[model samples]
Target: MEEIERIVSGKKGKIDVTPIATIFRNEIKEEVTKGQMKPRIVAFLTTDDAGAIEYAKWTKIACNRDGIEFILKKIERLDLEDAIIDANNDDEVHGIMVYYPVFGGMLDAYLQDVVSPAKDVEGMSTTNRFNLYHNIRFLDEKQTKKCVIPCTPLAMVKIIDHLGIYDKSLPMGEHLKGKNVTIVNRSEIVGRPLAAMLANDGAFVYSVDISGVICFQAGKRQGTIKMTETTVTRDEAIQKSDILILGVPSPKFKIDESLIPEGAVVINFAGCLNVEESVESKTILVPTIGKVTIAMLERNLLRLYQNQMQSRSTSSSSSSAQIDQPQQ
Candidate 1:
């Protein structure tokens, strides 16, 4: 087999995500300083989940480095919703994130629904979900008017854009035109949202699930997505795809090394051994979820602060105009 070039590791070596993360942090710190606001993020975590605990540790480190206060509240399965609600109502909490597998995923929906959309930094609220699905475009160049996007999908797109997969001169939705992309999972959090996003970006997207293959077409407003039952196997999809996304959360779901053609970009969202080691050199392995999540949290915090500032400025300008008006 011929040697495949690694996307993340190039001529200079493995791309340093640390510097990219630092840039995000510095920009956020500057925004917080200019706005004279203390930004804080509250994470509601399960008491016993080892993964959640480890994730929280990295989150704290990132928050500390960026000058944002990180608060971790341990809650039982029953009190999860209440904790999220409290975080939403707290004036100091600019962002709220809940670690998953809470009560073995039984309370995921309840916790997600209870968090206020304004504070839902993880983009789990119904409002954000609707906006993402509908391809709603916010006119504000600052993106303060749009809803928060899920970090994993956001990070994936950013990496791909950085790799010049998208035309830099054009808008995001026009970037992947003529590209054939395949996503190998359909979960709500990662796979489904990612498919919608990529489809909106004009890629010919094939979302594979046990049920069938769902084809997506980019529309002017609300894009069209159609699902059809098919007998196509995973290997068949991989063989024909230009870009392959794997989100299957199982070790047994490893891909056949021979199936991945040379120059195909592979992204693994599931933090497990789902892909073969040989693919690593040819793939862009997403950094740990915690790192990307922290970067996104900083972004959300800046947007929230900027929106608040803009609102205040608009209100103050209106008041001044009223004072200057002639009495009639």
Candidate 2:
């Protein structure tokens, strides 16, 4: 845990996304008070898995705090796809999130594909995934208008920005440009999207799996991410990385303190034992996750509210125009 503290103390200080979340929540409250449409998020859970339940609870707390209504729908595995489709078509629902590890990981694909991109607050839909890969400005753009991004990776970026990893003077999207970032995991939810986002922002990203498969991709938007994979010892990648992100999902996974370069920025996304204690002071650590999720959810809800308000304004204007037209 000492390593965790050191990670927090690096750069400007302990990186906290709470302030970011608070800003969104306050904005949401203001909008609701002004008689704008209220936003609601529905979470579909097919299993009673501990992790999923915990996430559901967190999401509820976040929604409540942000002034958005939270609905939890527990359904059977067979009904998962239909349930997501229903939520997609529901005009009252602004966002949809499906808890994972359902049926021993049986329904992952359906959850990823069935949720509509418009309400996919977790950024699991194919359209959102493609946008994450192709648009570097996704995060900076209005969340309701752009592809919704996965909470964890979005949290990581916010934390890094909070810690001054990038120059504050530059725009948020350009912060990671030209940085060498190494992500030590390859999960579809976290590693893959993160790598794609960073690369899209002009950062040279290296994604490493536990099996020592290192995939290098240029952070450019002109073409497809032509990943060049090669097998190498893990230590080499650690030594070369400027900013290291730990998302490996193994409890026993630990990095050698000596391998971590001095002054490197370390982001612990998996909540696992990835960083050793010896290098705690030498690297900046970003360890919080809950606040980031809260922030992302608030941003998502605010965007939805904005879109709803815009639609209402347009309809109202059209109705007034029709009423003013001279009747024959």
Best-fitting candidate, scored by TM-score: 1
Give a tens-digit lDDT track for model 2, residues 1-328.
3433444554323344566556556776676667645788888888777877887787788778667788999999789877877776676787888777665453586567676666667766666666666553342233424446777787777666555557556665556666778898887788888887676555677788856655656534453464776665567877877788887667788787788777888777775657764455676655556667666776766665565455556555311110111111
Global lDDT for candidate 2? Answer: 0.67
For all candidates in order, the CA lDDT equals 0.67, 0.67
The local lDDT score (0 to 100) that residue 26 gets in candidate 1 is 79
Per-residue C-alpha lDDT of model 1 across residues 1-328, encoded as one tens digit per residue: 0111343334211233454556567787776677677778888877777877887888888777777888898878688777776665565677788888776564677567677766667777666666678654431334545567777777667656665578656775678888878888887777878888887787877888777787765766545444444566667877888778877777787878678766677767676756676665655443234455578777876665455456456555311110111111
The reply for model 1, stretches above 4 Å from the true place, is: 1-16, 104-106, 137-144, 169-172, 220-231, 281-290, 308-328
Output the worst ten-in-a-row residue range by lDDT, candidate 2: 318-327
lDDT of 1: 0.67
Query: Candidate 2: which stretches are off by over 4 Å?
Result: 1-20, 31-35, 104-106, 136-145, 168-174, 214-226, 230-232, 308-328
Task: Please give each candidate's TM-score.
Answer: 0.82, 0.80
Q: What shift in Å separates residue 281 of candidate 2 from its native position after superposition?
A: 2.9
